[model samples]
Target: MIEQDRALYRPLWTVSFDEAVTLVRAGIAAAMRHQVKDLLVDTTALRGFPSPGTFQRFLMAVEWAEEASGRIRLAMVALGEMIHAQKFGVTVAFNRGLVNNVFTTELEALAWLDVEPGKGSPTRRQ
Candidate 1:
């Protein structure tokens, strides 16, 4: 399942091929609905990777999102080597159009998300 939370406008994903696509679709929908120019996605909970075909489909969805939102800045929180690798592929799939980075900690991710200190912290739970 893919759940988008209001907190930090963050999206959390379950580890599955279908859910990954759902996450991508949901992200695009959320961006369009909110007119968001940036996104912080947390995939630390996802255990494995989606299949190549699933990944491609997600990429296609993201490409369409690019047209709607221009260049969206994305920060992904992927705490471990496995998760980091998965996010790396996602960043690469975004190509050069989007600014994407993967981080191991929520603080770093929040910083990259561009929120200034003292404004409020986007809780990691979401």
Candidate 2:
């Protein structure tokens, strides 16, 4: 169950590239719908991304996010392998004027997003 504490969002997924895109788009739209400025997205279980298209996939997600929220802080919790060594994808997103980053743990993402643990109501999606 994906939950939200204030603007904090936590969703776990193991889907294909296409499904991931759909989720990213919907997730950002949902955060915007709730008027969230700083969003913490837990994607630690996110999987099935095509090996060679990770960069392009991330670009699409970031673009969708930008279209959804304009300027918003996005923190994501994902597996280590999903995190680029140089964080190039993150850099690209940040370069596009979106405050974005990826972490290996929820705590780290929450800290980055400045969201307190266990505070506010969680709004579940799907």
Clash pairs for candidate 2: none
Off by over 4 Å in 2: 1-5, 50-58, 115-126
How far is 76's C-alpha from truth in model 1 (Å)?
1.0
What local lDDT score does residue 96 receive in model 1, on the 0 to 100 scale?
38
Candidate 1: where are CA atoms >4 Å away? 1-15, 47-69, 83-91, 94-96, 115-126
TM-score (C-alpha, index-matched) for candidate 1? 0.55
Candidate 1 clash figure, as a count: 0
How does each model score on lDDT? 0.52, 0.62
TM-score of each: 0.55, 0.72
Q: What is the lDDT of residue 59 in candidate 1?
A: 64
lDDT of 1 by residue, 67-98 (tens): 43544555556556534334544445445345
Query: What does candidate 2's lDDT look like per residue over 7-76, in tens digits?
Result: 6555566687667657766777777777667667676667777532666756665676576554466777
lDDT score for residue 80 of model 1: 64
Q: Local error of candidate 1 at 25, Å?
A: 3.5
